[model samples]
Structure formats: C-alpha cells, structure tokens
Target chain A: MADRVRVKSWMPPGHIRTPAYLRGKTGEIERRLPAFPNPELLAYHLPAPDIPLLRVRFTMEEVWGADAERPEDVIEAEIFAHWLEPA
Target chain B: MPHDHAPHPYRPDQDGPLTEAQVTEIAIRELLIEKGITTASEVTAEVEAMDARSPAQGARVIARAWTDADFKARLLADGTAACEELGIEMGTLKLVALENTETTHNVIVCTLCSCYPRNLLGLPPDWYKSRAYRSRTVKEPRAVLREFGTRLPDKMAVRVHDSTADMRYLVIPSRPEGSDTLTEDALAALVTRDGMIGVTQL
Candidate 1:
C-alpha cells in the first residue's frame, strides 16, 4: 500500500491571501519558505491563528515592470511559499 | 448521519451577547489555533500594533502626495521605497504598494481578506475590509466613493485596484492648490487615512 501524496499548493483560488499583482507573473523563486497548514484550516480548528512560513524577496522590476518603460525601476515584494515542480 | 441540518452547539445564536460577527471571529480564531496556522498571542499582539500605526502614517503619505510632485513620482515608481525614503520602515516581503495618479484615481480593496499596505498606511479601515465596500468599489466605484463623501468630477476617472494578493494600493490624490502656506505637519493633518484609501479627500 502506497501512502497518498496530497498535491496541495498555497496559491489557489478563493484565498484571502496575496494580491493578484504577485501571482503567475514569474519571477526568480528567490527562496523556499517553510510550510504550514493554511490559515483557513488553522482557523477551523484553533482558538487563535498564526501563519508560519518563510518569505521570498522579489525585485520591483520583476513584479510591476518586467514590461515597464523605465529600466531603472526597481521595487521589491515578498511572497509566501514556493511552488514545487511536479516530480 | 446523512442529513443533520441542526445547528452545532457552537452556533452564534446559542452564544450570549456576541453578535454573529463576534461569534464568527471567535470560531475562526479557535480554528486557526487548533490547526496551527497562528498562535493566539501573536494574532492579538499584531492586531494591537497595527491599530496603533496605520492612520497617522497614512495621513502623512497622502499629504506628501498632494503637495510634492517629485515625491509623488518617486512614490508612483516604487511605493515601498518611497516610503522608506520618507523614513517609513517596511517589511521587505508580504507587502505590495500601488499608486493612483492623475487621469486615474486608485482605490484598493481586499475581496478575500484585508490585504493592506500596513507599512505605508497602517491597517486598512473597517469599511475597506467590509463586504459592501469590497463588492461595490470595483463594480460601482463612483457610488462607493459617494458613500465616503467623495463626488468625483464627471471628467475624472476612477480606477479600482483589488488587493487580491498580498499587494495593496495607496491613493495619491491630486494636490489641493492654495495650500502653499500649509506646513508639512499641517498638510499631513489634512491627509486622512480615508484619503489614502480613496474613500475621502484630504
């Protein structure tokens, strides 16, 4: 009997999480954040909830202006969790 | 086991004095702690700190945007950086800042949750995080701003930005002329937290 692997990913629809500006707009994966159960899940079971995870740093040009007019434009943002390519 | 529509023992009406809103919050917090999303102390502490910070800072940013073109340009280019240049400390990640300029007035809403620019303006206002504001701001911005006591000129355009991710937006309102004599502090005083959210004007 093989154990089941839940193909759960954090970035998905219906989450009160990150803004649209940060998603699907590929940038360097910068770092791998620690994983924790989702907030909605935790809120379903706990008295108080805290989100535990690592943060990724993204430069501004990578976010708003990979296509922006000014090349010198540099801004930064942090996204939670890293997407893992299928094995 | 098949069809139990009966209320749970923890249902809102069963609780005393607490509104459905209060009950929902209690239940949600319980679930989060039970599931290890966050600890109670951390949530409580952070909420307290956020309440203490957002408004005053939001006021300052709005005021500067209203008065300084160079500052406004820098803010539009890189909001977090612009704030830091003005001495606002921000977390390097989990935050997004957007600017609303002339020919466009930007208003932010977090439909999923209150994903706000806590660094620049502090936490979002209660209305901004409300369902009514969230739903209508995008679909009927003029109506929404009207509720906030703002009546946009017929020619001006309103662009609503959703803080659908961790990203947030700050409204850089047009500067009010004849304010040349106003000191920075006085100008900042005119900048309301609501002004930054684009619900009201400074």
Candidate 2:
C-alpha cells in the first residue's frame, strides 16, 4: 500500500528541502529515496547526518484548493523525513 | 551570433574594466592554481567537456526509447542507469523519467532552485532558472504551458514534478504519430530540448 503523508507546515529559517507552498499539504508517497546528508545541516557546514527522503505526490486540489486548474492534476516533490509527518 | 559590421551590439568585458565578479573569479582561480588544488588547463578541459554536451545526447536516449520498448522500460525503471547504459556520464545525478502519455502530460521544475539533468540535456535554459517560471509552473502549470504554446484538452491531467531534492526530473515525451517507420537517428533529430523539458511537443 502507498503510504500517505503530509508535509509539515513549519517555517523555521534555514535551508529546507520542502517548498513553502507545499506546507500543510497532504499527499501519497510516490516512492522512497535513498538517505542523503541533510541539506539544512550541510548548508551551514554543520555535522550533517543522513536523512531519508521520499517523493510525495499531491493533487492540485489538495495543494491549491479551489484555485486548482484541475482536481486530478498532480505535483510531486522530494520531502525530507523531517518535513513529512503521517497524515 | 556576431556580425563583423562597423557597429558591434555587444561590448564584451574587454571593452570595459573587469567587473567585481570577474575579478573575484580570477583571484580564486589564481589562488587555487597556486595552491596546487587545480590548474588552468584542468578548468579549460572541464569547460570543454561541458561544452561538448547538448540536447542531442538526450534526444538519442529518447529516440532509442521510441524505437526500443525494452530500453524504455529500463529508462522508466532507473533513468540514471539507463542513460549510463547508453554511455552518457550521469555522474552522481539521479534521475526520474516521467513518461508523457496521451491522457497525461508531464512537466519538470525545481521550485527551490534550478535542478536539471544537465548531463543529458546540457545546461538549463535561462527561463528555467527564473523565479517567475519556478513559482508559476507549480501554481499554474496549464497557464505556463499555454504560454509555451502547448495546449492540452481540459480533460488531460497535467503532472508537474517539483524537483525539490536530490533527483532531477526528465519528461519522456511521446513519439509523434506517423513517425513509426522513421530511423532512430531521424527520430532523434525530431526531438527538441523543449520537448524533453515538456514545454513543447515535437
């Protein structure tokens, strides 16, 4: 079964992989990606640790509400594990 | 495109004093060379290698997929490995091949920054790196596609990939109708960089 996830709405000031527009939006996991050094930490040359990444697929309706051009149209993005929470 | 006319439209850097960015670049280059980190010849060679890349490399892959079903399956399964199988150096670039079907159209964008399959398609276009294109592609893809003169039926679902992380995205555009009998090289010639980017169809 495809895992359902929601992007966390946090806006902490730092280098983040998640887009602002996708905050608080829920989507299905399209696929799980390999772990990589977190960009948020790597950006500052901090002690970077590997983090899991997932490609989450969100429908236009979920992302844009009534302003969506079509309900079925989709948007997929790679969200770090920290940015994703179980919906 | 330069014209050897009396009036030159472009004033190259030599026409004026070096800009701050250019000066900084020269300084860094000199320091790096002095420190034995890299040589000017290595930099020039790297630039030459980059210059050797173009959309033709990507077109070859697309054309191969069009003519060979097995290759297309492999490409969809693992884009980087599939490209490497064709002797294209993908380096550490992971790729996801989004196939554009009749019922759906696929487009790629990096809303965070300019993430692209540069190895296959060469450099990303100037418009692809602009904030307007980045923001609008996710918000209003249909409108942006219309601006590119690509109009799909309202019923067709548009899938936009916001490459916000490690993997770069490429749209494998469907082969045009009535081109089944064409040779692979001929079909490759028909493929355009815009088509691979999902901005236009061949």
Candidate 3:
C-alpha cells in the first residue's frame, strides 16, 4: 500500500530543501530514499542528524489546480520525513 | 561623500570586477589555505576534474544502453554502478536513470537549487539555472517543454522529477526510430544534452 502524506506548510527562514509550491500539498509516497544528514541544519554548519527522505508523487492538478496544462501529468519530489504529515 | 582616487586592488585586465559573492569565496578559500584546511593545488585539481566532464560521456552511456539490453537493465536498476561498468567514475553521489517510454516521459529539475549530474553531462546550461525555468517547470511543465520545442502527445504522461536530495537524475531518452543500421558511435552522435535532460527528444 502506498503511503499518502501532505507536505507541512512550515515557512522557516533559511536554506530549505522543500520547495514552497509543494507546501501544504498532498501526495503519495513513491518510495523511501536513504537517510542523509539534515541539509537545513548542515547549511548553517550545525551538527545535522540523519533524517529519512521519501520520494513523493503528486498530480499536476494537485499542485497547480486549474492552471495546470495537463491535469493527468505526475510530478515526483524528494522530501525529507519531517516535512510530511499523514494526509 | 569623501571620494579618494585609488587604484583598485583587482587587476583590471586579468581579474575584472569580482562580484560580492566571488570576493567572499576568494576570502574563504584564502583563509582555508592559510589555516592549512586545504591547498591551492587541491582546489585547482578539483576544478580541472570538473571541467573534464561533458555531454559526450552521457551520450556514450545512452548509446550503449540503446544497443545492449543487459546494460540497460543495470542502468535502470543502479545508475551509478552501471556508469562504472563503462568506466565513468560517478564518485560517491547517487544517480538515478529515469527511462522514457511510449506512455511516460521524464523531465528533471532542482527547484531549490541547480543540482545536476555534473559528473556525466558537465555544468548545466545558463537557462537551467534561470529563475523562470526553476519556478515554472514544476508548475507548468508542458508549456515549458513546448517552449523548448518538445511537444508531446496529449496521451503521453509527463513526469517531472524534482531533484531535492543528493540523488541525481539522468533521463534515458527513448531511442529514435529507423536507426537500426547505425553503429553505436553514430547513434551516440544523435544524442544531445537537451535530450538527456528531457527538455527535448533525440
């Protein structure tokens, strides 16, 4: 079964991995990627703990709504675990 | 405002005017070298190594994949290892090859920054780093692809891969039709940088 999750809309001020457009958007988890040090913290030269990353898939309609050129098109993004919440 | 006429520290003919970011980079580099963090020769060697990569390397990989089924399987399964089969050193970074099929097409973008498969395809083009391409590709890919003169059929599904993490993506474009008689070298000649990036098809 695919894990469905929504990106949390947390707008912190700094270098971020998650794109702003995908924030608050729901998507299906495609697969789990290997864990890596938190880039958000790494950018600041802080000790960054390892975090799980997931490849999430969302339809064009979900991201752009009526403005989407092709509603059936799919987009995948690599998002860290902490940025996602169960939809 | 008190103005003093002084010769600029930067040699006009050799260095030109450095941007603030470039000046900061120089400062950091000099500090690191001064502190014995790294050597100037090490930095120069790294830059030269990066400069050696080009799209031709990627084209050769694509050509081999087109002709060899087992190689193609290995490429799709583990891109980094597959590249090594042809002696293309991918270093420690992970690479994923997305296959374009009859029903699905793949495009790559790094919305947060200009992350790319520099090991295979050299430095990314200026347009790829532009704000318009970065922001618009995710929102409206079809229009963007169209602008690049790559029009897909309405039935074909477009899949845009956002390279947000360390894993770099390389699009394995479908082989062109009616080229069965061509050699691997000839077929490789047909592959373009844009084709590998999924902005256009070969």
Per-candidate fnat, comma-separated:
0.11, 0.91, 0.89
lDDT score at residue A17, model 2, on the 0-100 scale: 83
Residue-wise lDDT of candidate 2 within B1-202, one digit each (tens)? 1111245355477767899989999999999999999999999999998998888888999999999999999999999999999999898899899898889899999898899899988888778999999989998999998888899887788999998989988889989999989999999888888888887766
Candidate 3, residues B41-82, lDDT tens digits: the string is 999999998888888889899999999999999998889999
lDDT of 1 at B189: 65
Which segments of model 1 are wrong by more than 4 Å?
A1-87, B1-48, B92-102
Q: Which scores better on DockQ, 1 or 2? A: 2
1 or 3, greater by TM-score: 3
lDDT of 2 at A4: 92
i-RMS for every candidate (Å) is 8.9, 0.7, 0.9
- Model 2, residue B149: what's the lDDT? 84
lDDT on C-alpha atoms for all candidate structures: 0.56, 0.89, 0.89
Docking quality tier of model 1? incorrect
lDDT of 3 at B106: 96
Residue A31, candidate 2: how far off, in angstroms?
A: 1.0
The local lDDT score (0 to 100) that residue B154 gets in candidate 3 is: 76
Model 2: CA > 4 A from native? B1-11
